[model samples]
Target: MSGGVDSSVAALLLKRAGYDVVGVFMRNWTEPDAAGRCSAEEDFADVRRVAEAIGIPYYAVNLEAAYREKVFAYFLEEYRRGRTPNPDVMCNREIKFGDFIEEALKLGADFVAMGHYARVRREGGRVLLLRGVDAAKDQSYFLHQLSQAQLSRALFPIGALTKAEVRRIAREAGLATADKKDSTGICFIGERDFRQFLKTFLPAQPGEIVNVDDGRVLGRHEGLMYYTHGQRHGLGIGGGFGPGPWFVAEKDLVHNRLYVAAGRDHPALFATALLAEDVRWIAGAPPDRVFRATAKFRYRQPDRPVEVEVLDERRAFVRFEAPERAITPGQSVVFYDGEICLGGGVIDRVRRPYFEARRSAFGDVFDRVLL
Candidate 1:
């Protein structure tokens, strides 16, 4: 539940619906702070308090080994290949719905539920994934990697309400987490300096920042893994030749150089069509070979029109009808039909303007669940 208002209300709703709800606070990893204490103690305590208030069975599960093997290792491997990996997506697939769901089922629970802002429905014995009613807080993007079996056993009680409504319901129920601040940054990592946390596991190779067009040195970057596709601030690059703020145009890992250009509209970074790998469709498969749908290349982005093509059983690609800015590698491209989730893949290649190709080696990582 993450000890948040959303999950607390989810438990309340399920309890009111006559379902035997057990509140679980999953401990994915032990991230100790500068004081040598696990940072998750506060959230865990809050979740426990909410569970006590709700009068349900509450327990904490340690999945640190699973998280390290599945998500953290993959994160380090992706960054080693010069790509930004979404650890949250991997956490959902490997920890929450994967290990936690199995644990819940093993404990004789009928179903596993969470505070995710997405919905799952059964139509004619086929399971379908749908977006949350609260569009602004929808989290189906992080859930694209769920397998058919996991989606069938999953429940999302907060899918019907907005964030504000969730808070209200929690307040009405007298839950302690009603006013709790939302957890931000990497799921297990919390709000620590991102690059600093990553440095512990990744080898830091200092590199140079240069202008994309002229190849002139602008500044020095800590490493290629320290930056992402569309980052603007904390670049430490001096600005003089631009009218507006500059954005990272490209990361040339081969030469260990970063390329910056003026503004987010830099032609070299925007892409019309994106090639995604490791695609998953929650509705079994796409209804048609070439179907029009709404696709998002990053989390918190509005869906855009696109045509999806199944390249193979394990790989697929989507071509956006309009150019997408910062269609970055390592980020997931989740597809949707109205509010229903159509599935998506990791963005492998973003086609740059004028035929320059930005490529990566970690283009197709997927489904590494331990048997």
Candidate 2:
């Protein structure tokens, strides 16, 4: 719940529905701030206030060691390997539904309820995961990795309400978190500077920022670990070929070099195909080996038409209808058949154009593209 209005309202709704409602705030991160205080403590205080206002029994479960081992350790490892893994997806799969659900059942819980902006329903004796009614706040992407058993025991109370309506409900109920700002991004790091925070764990090794289009070393980068695909800010690059801003096209982990491009529309940033590994289908089984669907490589990306060919048990190739820009490895590519999420996987690598695989600036792979 993290002491937010959404979760507070979730508890209220559950209690109203005649269900035994208990609020549990899991303490997964214990990283101390510069002031020698754990931010989770402040969040726990807010949880307590919210729980009291909602008139429910609340408890704070310590999951720091488990989170460090399962989620945080893998997050650092991915960065070290030059991949930007989405910790939020892994956190939902490992922590929220894994250890936390186990704890809930031990307390004789029939099911676990969350404030996630997603929906679940039972259709033909199978529980289905669906997008939230709020299009702008739909979180089915992060919830894509959830398994059938997990979805069966999960409940989302705020799935139908808009963000504004959620706040209004909290205010009407006189909940303390009524006006609380929604927490964005990863929860562990909060609002800390990413590079400075990462330095505590991974010592940055400065490398030459090389231009990808032309073999030109423009400037020195702080570290490859601090950068990701299509990043333009905080790169410390200046005075290139023209009065220009350079974007991070790629990170050469082998050479420890950061590749930069002249502009956002650089050809090197686009990819027509990608290989996805570590796939998880929410339906407890993969869909057809070869199927056409819409996919989103990043959370903010619109669903683009794609043709997926499942290769093995947990691998597949996705050919996007249009060339995707900066299809970074280690990010999840969620596929959907219309509004129903078809599930997806981690991007292992992306395939761009060479001489034999050239594409036009408008994303046409050949001289003529089919309508």
Could you tell me the lDDT of residue 360 within candidate 2? 41
Candidate 1 residue spans exceeding 4 A from truth? 35-37, 241-244, 355-371
lDDT tens per residue, model 2, 128-236: 8888888888889999999989888999999988999999989999888899888787767776777888898998999898877656888889888888888888888
Model 2 alpha-carbon drift over 4 Å, by segment: 35-37, 354-371
Single out the weakest 10-residue window by summed lDDT for candidate 1. Answer: 362-371
Could you say which candidate leads in TM-score?
A: 2
lDDT of 1 by residue, 254-297 (tens): 67878777777877667777678777778767768878888888
Error of 2 at 288 (Å): 0.5
Clashing pairs in 1: none
Q: What are the C-alpha RMSDs, in order, of all predicted structures?
A: 4.6, 4.6
What alpha-carbon RMSD in Å does predicted model 2 have with respect to the real structure?
A: 4.6
